[model samples]
Target: MSYFPAFLKLDNKKILIVGGGYIAYEKLEHLLDFSSNISIIALELSDNMKRVIEEKSLNFEKRGYQKGDIKDFAIVIVAVDDIPLQARIFAESKEYNCLCNSVDSVDYCDFIFPSYIKKGDLTIAVSTSGASPAVAKHLRKYLQELIPSSIGEFLQEMKELRKTLPKGKERMKMLDKKAHDYINTWSSK
Candidate 1:
């Protein structure tokens, strides 16, 4: 089955990563784009992982994952290569009311990470339901190039206008036209 696409606001959510290898590092990099409330528990951390942990001042445990390691997290990512370990963690995550994502293992994943492009407030996600991440990645890159770099600033202007304008259909129509015109102008250049 296909996965639903939605955007999550990670304002106060806590995330956990149960690995310290390169794959775990990749997950960490993606999570860091949206949140910093993350902790890791793994037997050994890669050098790059250790550096990022130190730089971000994130909590971590060098020991192997314990039974209750995921109890306080809202999302848990099992980046370890062991399928059994991922399965165990996925089951445990259910008891803790947390979402689990096991890297490269769709059977153990509550949700798959879609390749995305983020430009300030704009984020576009591309997914193939775990079929072809390479295609999704390349599509994301192509979409990114098509977007103007000043989109964030333009959105900020629209935000201010919305806040100042009174609520009505006129306001909605005006904003819609403004956005449509902006996109058309950018594409034309």
Candidate 2:
């Protein structure tokens, strides 16, 4: 089945991650790019995980995840290797109406993380409906190379134009022309 694509505003929202090993650490790294309001629950943390927590100054509990640990969080990521625990947390997350992702277990996941490229305010997400993550990653990398480095600057210029130009059909036409011209020029580089 195909999943809907949506961008969430995560500012001030609570996010819970259950685990602190290598898999959890990987998820944490990706999450850090989008939000800082994350709390991790784990029995023990890896060195890299500890460093990220300390650097970000995130909320953490140094113990095993409890039955009700997913409370009040907007999103919950279960990265533990134990399948039963992943399933249990995913099931419990539903009680709190939280979106849950059980890392590699698609059966218990409410959503899956997509491979993405972030350039300044621009974000492009690539997904294959949980079919092949490797392909998604490769596509993201290809897109990253294909996109021009000047795109961020171009976006900033567009933002300025949007603010300065008055609301009218003329403004829309001008903006459309500018975007088309910029893309045509950048694609040649």
Winning candidate number (TM-score): 1
lDDT value, candidate 2, whole model = 0.91
Query: Candidate 1 regions off by >4 Å?
Result: none
Error of 1 at 53 (Å): 0.8
Clashing pairs in 2: none
lDDT of 2 by residue, 39-71 (tens): 999999999999999989999999988888778
Error of model 2, residue 51, in angstroms:
0.8
TM-score for all predictions?
0.97, 0.96
- Residue 125, candidate 2: alpha-carbon lDDT: 97
| Residue-by-residue lDDT tens digits, candidate 1, 65-172 | 888889989999999989999999999999999999999999999899999988888888999999999999999999998999999999899999999999999999
Per-candidate RMSD vs. true structure? 0.9, 1.1
TM-score of decoy 2:
0.96
